[model samples]
Target: MTGAFDGLKVVVHVFGKVHDAGDGQGMLCRLDLEGLELVATQHRVEAGASPRTVRFPLRTTEISYGGTDDGKLVLKTPEHILYAERDELEPELKRLGLVSLDHVLSRERQLLGGRRRKGLAVWVAVLAGCIALAFGALWLADWAVARAVDLTPAPWEVQLGQAVLDGQTWDEVTDPEVIEPVGKITERLMAEAGEHPYDFRFKVVRDPQVNAFALPGGGVVIYTGLLENADTPEELAGVLGHEVQHVLWRHSLRGLYDRLKWHVLVAMVLGDISGAQELLLAQAAGLMQLSYGRGMEREADRRGVELLVRAKIDPQGLHDFFGKLSEQEGTPESLTLLSTHPSSRERQEYLKELIEENSGARYQPLDVDWEGLQEKLKGGAGIER
Candidate 1:
């Protein structure tokens, strides 16, 4: 009737659950675009029954028509996908002013490709940011730790050392008589140490471990075991000299920094000055138990020998002390000095080389009664100066 579809006869194959078409095969149909319907004039039926007519609604705006690989036209919609002869459908599409199937498909592909490219760029940027953040965290940690150490005030360091010793009583050697000779040696070493900001406190703990350790802010704790082992005042001077240099070089602070770097970075970033101070004070008491790295030990040894030379006490005594420690068995409790100091023949040889380099320098004795001090310690008598 030329009412909806241009009154043209077209052969079509429809697939899907449309209302009345019911998946007709090779049916002759007329399209009705105005009414959005497809009416079949002749469709398959029972052999004895009259030929049936069927109607299916068409949604032209939602239908997608494309050329198939087998030279047929295929149309797809949310409700149905249908096939028709290219010769039958192409003319109708042209008459309706619809673009060719190839143009529509190309536009869809371009739109999809643009979306994929945009998504890929976003993912790449996110990945780059994550990698940069990982490396930045590492670099920032190192730089922040060094800055924290440099910014610490001298008085705070002293207070940190005191906090470590505030509560514990180790029956430490407080007798001035026993302390005087040790103080004399320390004073001689400091005289040549040049100007410094620390008020050095030296203490002798009554423990029997052959070890001595230095605290930040100029606290040096020596065990009686170390004193008992030393055969000469010069050897004791050597050990004190080494410990003194550790304080001067701030090795404890450096070691403490390694432990607290991440916390320091976080605190500095948040500008939490009081939190950082509390952290340092809380954690620093463990400094006495910390072991220095090999590089730090070497630096302390090298600088300590130089100090001994300036004081003109024999530098060979340090070498001899190392030799004695190296001879002792590595018993865990009794030989803590050996364990911590890592005494070796290689270190003794290095010390020998240092002394020989200063062979031309005149050496004098430290005027202390070494034998009498040992006898008192051996006799278990309280020393009186």
Candidate 2:
């Protein structure tokens, strides 16, 4: 009876000496077998439970009869029932309904291993995709910003900035005390800068934070705080020269270009610059984040020093300004410096080296009306006295 059966349900009967220890009664035993185990059992019988006597049904794959020997007879089923004189029945039960230990182990291992491999593969692919996306995003941003700057008209930038400044009259915005010195320095620098294709204009802002920035169309803003810190005209000139270089090289435009490069790529793919314009507008509004590359900052510094030398101004001014800013590193004022420029000790050193190397060469100084320009700026409201 050690065989296999494929079925949904099985009923088995066991017959043997059966006694109900509970209530001092006898009971017949019948068991329901399912799947493989039913076919494994060798013998089957039927019986019931009663108070006086219990006749049990017995079903088993193997049976052994012992003459002149008393031993307990047992029946085993798929789920319950413990005692059974069924050594031969073991193989039959496994073949019919019971799961073999080896088979169970093998099935579990296969399932777990397959799941683990699948999970690992999925995670690896996702991680790789993220890395690729990050690189692609950076590349696209660079390209788009470049294209945008090329497309923007230089005159347009100047006009826009002029219009903004024009809306507020000089009397309403200029600070007399600071404006005078700043204006004097700027006039000399611009005259020294001399007829570059770009239209350069300088303005003094009343802010106390030490900072200076260049606009896309050669517009330079010098904060009063910077002028306050500058002990010499050379320092002011160096700073102004640096900002001038930023304008001449179109660094602000380039920065805008670099930042919006990716958006331009997307726009080109979509067949228009309109999308890029929208992105640029967002950036201008400070709604989008962008940063200039280190290379751009370095180039501005190098060129600024060159301009100072050409103007017969001491390049040491640039180095000194950078040195002072570097000293203030980690302070609130330093943070303001970092907003538009890279402040580093190495850069200051480089400027110093540049000045020393170019020391022997010199240029004629431009005749500038320092006092008159100062008076003009001083008359303005925002220009501090």
> What is the clash count for each candidate, in the order shown?
2, 53
Which residue runs does candidate 2 get wrong by more than 4 Å? 1-119, 167-196, 254-265, 278-293, 329-335, 356-385
Q: Per-model C-alpha lDDT, please?
A: 0.73, 0.59
- Model 1, 60-143: lDDT tens digits are 423333344234555554444455565665556455543433465446557657766888999999999999998999889878
**Model 2 lDDT per residue over 44-148, tens place:** 344653323222223332222221221333433333332333333334444444545325434544655776689899999999999999998877777666666
TM-score of 2: 0.59
**Estimated TM-score per prediction?**
0.63, 0.59
Report how far off residue 103 is in candidate 1 (Å). Answer: 34
Query: Looking at model 2, which ten-residue stretch has the lowest summed lDDT?
Result: 61-70
**What lDDT does candidate 2 reach at residue 45?**
42
Distance from true position, residue 219, model 1, in Å? 1.2
How displaced is residue 222 in candidate 2, in Å? Answer: 2.3
